[model samples]
Target chain A: MNNSQDLPLKNDIAARFLPLIIGLMVYVGTLCFVFTLFILSATHLWENQLRTQITLEVPASPGASSAPLQAQVLQVLSKTPGIQQASAVPKKEVETLLQSLLGTTLPVDLQFLPVLIEVSLNGREPIDIPMLEARLKIISPQIQLIDHRPWQVQVSSLINASVVLASTLTFLVLLTALVTTTFATRTSLLIHRQVVEVLHLIGATNEYIAKQFQVHALKQGLIASAIGAAFAFLTFIGIAALLEKAGLPSTSLSSFSIQAFCVFALSPFVTGGFMMLSARLTVMRGLRP
Target chain B: MSDFIAQFVGVGHQYKKGAEIFKGATFNIEPGSFHFLTGPSGSGKSSLLKMLYLGLKPTWGSIRLFGEDPLTMKPSLLPLLRQQVGVVFQEFKLLDHLKVIDNVSLPLRVRGIEAKRSYRDARELLNWVGLGDSLQAYPATLSGGQQQRVAIARAVITRPQLLLADEPTGNVDDDMAIKLLHLFEELNKMGTAIVIATHNQRLLERSPYPHLTIRRGTIIRTPKRSKP
Candidate 1:
């Protein structure tokens, strides 16, 4: 006949509020999920950049020239297995980096600055850090072998904590969405109890009544989640723009991977499907005699 | 098919608060029969009609509709039996949000019938009830008599095997009541069993159907008098 809904759900107060609540929850969840994705990508990029690189610091000697010790360290590194390249960091570049930190003034004599060396490994085999330290000590007892592994490990721990926090937040947001759907559906059933009873008396099955609620939930859920995801993507673009305006390198932001895009694309459908399921179950239980 | 459209054997009904409405009441509704269910208020007239339409189940004893025990039938299959039995509630339980035509065609729509066909049949029935122009109007906007007619149209839209009406003509005028009774008569002639529960003495005298009267929590059947 008219093909209109048997229940007047559109007029329900719950219907008006459900979409807004679901949209806000989806926004929070999408942000959390994207944050986790960004953290994971950044950690992966850092690991790849730091995996095969190490830095060496040669202290200045009072009675000997540090240039000779730096040259000896480079010679030793070149002869070692798995050592791809070795070179000293320019003293002037180090001095400029220090000036940026210490107000553009040389606090002490330039000769007192330690000689710094950059080392690259082939990455085919793991370097023996303790053995390298011993070898460097033979060259000069004041030499320091500073591998990047410890720093990377600390960064990894911090990133892992952030990912866990984001994931937990996303889970709680979704749970809240489900609870909201359930409560809204139940309230709708209560409000439309008489209409529902009329439908039941008119040869309508429970499944028929449930189908109405689920379809409403699905439509509302999809539109709300789409809006939420769109806002989240816009926020991402805004953050990227802000970073660029602040003179930060574009590479500092995590690039969107295919996985992240898929997550964003499927979020509406997933949320809608979940809401439909929740509404169906809540209506079924509420209609139970 | 069973000769009786409905059979109530040793049936009893009681409220949850332990108030027994009726006990050991037995009745059989044959196919294509029209009977008036009469009693004073609070005599379980509505309850009896409700049990016939599968809206309420007997607290004890057996009820067989369309040759199947409803109490023992699977809950999911109850709608199938309910579909075969149409009920017009005294309250005219129409959906307030739906337009008059939509409310009338709800039974057909619930059966998964095509919208065009169901709406056409609903429109024709509404025209017959003299509310053709009120198709788009909601139930809340209609008078009590018009709402009752809409309820009647909805009940008989499917041409069910058995029809149960509770005070079907209580809100309508004498003329409209007679017209509505004629509609039910036409349905009964088409092999539909009809049960009307009412206290209207004039309406009862107007028709020559047998009576199922309730007195002291028991049913007494008064067969139709033979024409002289």
Candidate 2:
């Protein structure tokens, strides 16, 4: 049923080595893809949470409780045409967040914590940031406006860099697999030169002989790719678990992105096809008298 | 595929022109004739066969196989033409990994015939060659004589229009050698054109087929005998 195994050179060193290298490439390729998805998911969530609001931080000053400054800023913001609504974050919430970050709030410095205000914009008006800054500065020179634009730019750049790196690695993995198949196919051709000669002598067309090698390559490619795929899948699960333990937002390695699932699913078939093509070409070239 | 299986005109061959291995050689075999090609060691017997099989183009002459110029034939067309020809190697070029039946069935398999479906023909041929019981055996496990028989079985299994063999019986005993010759005889009777290259002089006397002796890349035809 499977005729490629009937080929005498099937047990050659290169033949066995092909699957191992292909499997490793798939493993690394899957990791690169997974990391890219993780970045993408985190970036999307961060963008949604940060998109509509602007924040202002008011530092504590000597002999001045910032409650009055915060109320004045909010009153001024309410009068501004572009401001939808302005609200001051309670001091208790800020301290709770700082305690979680700094791991123990110093009792003495608790009252000295900065006052934070959130400003939501009405989409109908384009609020000028510098004008808002000058208006806020008139109330208190210590107020700092934190525009979300720079953060968005930085996040976009990071996401773009990661996407490009993942794509480059994917390209490299395919190239490596192709080179491995080509080299292995050539070696098999040379190893079985006499058998090939006999086949030729007996009236086998170059295509027929090439078909034999192609079938062999396809089988090998599929088998090796499956092994690689299984290993990659398991590694993703293990890495996801590790990431969860490290207190990071773990990627849904368990989350089936239909796109990623389809790509990984077709990888073995693509590998087999590549092997068949490369084998056909290599045999055709070798058969040239 | 054609009335004439092979034809050569001024067909001389050399790896390089002017430093010929053999030169200006011409020969032709009819559709169903059986012939022996005999010459000493290092003679051009193998080279001549190579040209006949389209393995090598003549350096400065013409070669026609199955009514097509081998030199001008499209590279893609060679396989179709080759399928009509069969060859048995002196080295017994059986794929050692394959079982005896598989080896014998390769010619048909290469042509896209289902190997399992063609088992009957392979079985019959192997049985006729005294290898019926060894169908499941590998070539490495077979003796030189057995390996040679497998090679012969493979060559003729396709019922090729032309069968070319190089020292097919070289490793066999004289009794087995005669038996092998008779197998070729049977194929020849079936209208398969056959040319056997051999160094065994006993076969030259044992049969009445024409001998196309090659001494220096040229055919020296022996006096004819009856085709009994």
Candidate 3:
């Protein structure tokens, strides 16, 4: 005798399974959205770190003291308009970097070690890398200027691809949820066709009948979406904890901005609206003469 | 409002891939008048009642209820028109999930009446139908006669301008049938038109109302016989 629901939708098989399926879909969708956000933030951080830095390599020359070549390159870099600071990388530090890669230590006086200079730019104006390279080449044909632009481009492409993939996955998850709701609503209509006809005979409007289904859908949808979002949040926490334990950075991946939290909070209501709309449309169509 | 609660003109109906059930059947039901709709099995008794309540539209013809042609009326207005008519289906058509009281109060709830008032009225009607104790019982748990009483309570709860009953006395005993007849008479006395479709010759013989008998896909009106 619950006046709120005229139909026995609570006993429905669809009612039992709809929340679970919708919850699973919402979980995947939330993860996809978070991952896209992570990738975007990580890309922005990497860009800021790489944009103002360049590397210059002064190759070793046999029977030539590279000190003069290194000093000459440093002088040329200082004369450049946009260059802020340039310093030669110590040989021991370079040796340690190579040792980490090759897993072997070199002799202290290995004369074949190239002279490396770390260059920092002010980033206020664009630097013509080819012009800078030509200036450095005048000092020695072996000098090479390497800016981070190419690496940044590759990283940006990878990030863009990840974002596209995540977006597509989120879209697919929502579409599946929508289709599930539609089928469930249609099945309910079929199962309760006799009850619906009785309601009609008793002077009930189609809107009246449809409202019952809509209310059922909204209730189920809201509960399922909340459960899904909560589970997704737990997953985010777990992943972040795992990443932290593994000695990796998890801030961008695990931390939610205000906008992200808002999106997550709004997901349930949005999903509920879609489900209610689907139920309403299905009822209207099923009841149509 | 129109003097006639419902009017049918040259109405005909058929199912898909089936022969016409009834054709060129025309009749007018005046306010507060009672009529017995009698017909042989499969004689379209149910179909005629369906058209009366706007449950089924005739394949061809014009029908008016509350002075509005249901066929030409706005679809949105159909429920408002239907609100003035009530039907007791032959199959009982009770929602198995709903309790007896809920089923009886359904018509009022559909009209957006407050539950407190609707349930109070439904409870009083159920008591009159001898279902006061079974108010909390589900339809599946009720006997056929009890369910029929529940349907009757639902149809009359609104005090609709017209009441259409199909085989209303089919599942009841002679005493309960007479009681139901008296109940209909009381509603008719209150200016609510009534139509009871039945095959019970005894009830027909006992009643003083005219009969609209469906004969060979046509309706034939028979005036009430004078008491001996």
The stretch of ten residues in a row with the least summed lDDT in candidate 1 chain A is A251-260
Question: TM-score of the candidate numbered 1?
Answer: 0.89
How do the residues A1-289 of candidate 2 rate in per-residue lDDT, one tens digit apiece?
Answer: 3344445656787687787888888777766776677668667767754665789998877677778888888888888778787888877788788888777735646567677888887757888889889999999888999989677888788888988999789778878888888888898888888778777777677887788889888888888887787777677667768877987654443453454566667778987898789889988888886
lDDT of 3 by residue, A1-289 (tens): 4564689999998668999999999989987897688668767877876888899989988788888888888888888888889998888888788887777754455478678899989889777889999988898888878888788888888888989999999999999999999899999999888889888878899999999999999999899999998888778777767867977675655454454676678889998999999999989988888
Select the stronger candidate by DockQ from 1 and 2: 1
Query: Among these predicted structures, which one has the highest TM-score?
Result: 1
Those runs of model 1 whose alpha carbons end farther than 4 Å from true positions after fitting are A1-3, A58-116, A121-124, A252-254, A257-266, B1-3, B224-228
Model 3: colliding residue pairs: none
Q: Which 10 consecutive residues of model 2 chain B have the lowest summed lDDT? A: B14-23
lDDT score at residue A100, model 2, on the 0-100 scale: 80
Where's the lowest-lDDT run of ten residues in candidate 3 chain B? B219-228
- Ranking the candidates on DockQ from highest down gives 1, 3, 2
Per candidate, native contacts kept equal 0.80, 0.75, 0.70
**TM-score attained by model 3:** 0.85
Which has the better lDDT: candidate 1, or candidate 2? 1
The clash count for each model shown is 1, 2, 0
Assign candidate 1 its CAPRI class: medium
- TM-score of every candidate's chain A: 0.83, 0.79, 0.80
Ranking by lDDT: 1, 3, 2
Model 2, runs deviating above 4 Å: A1-4, A58-92, A102-115, A120-127, A135-143, A249-277, B1-3, B15-21, B39-43, B173-178, B199-208, B215-217, B220-224
lDDT per residue for candidate 1 within A75-150, as digits (tens), equals: 8888788889988888788888788778665485668878888898899977888898999999878888888888
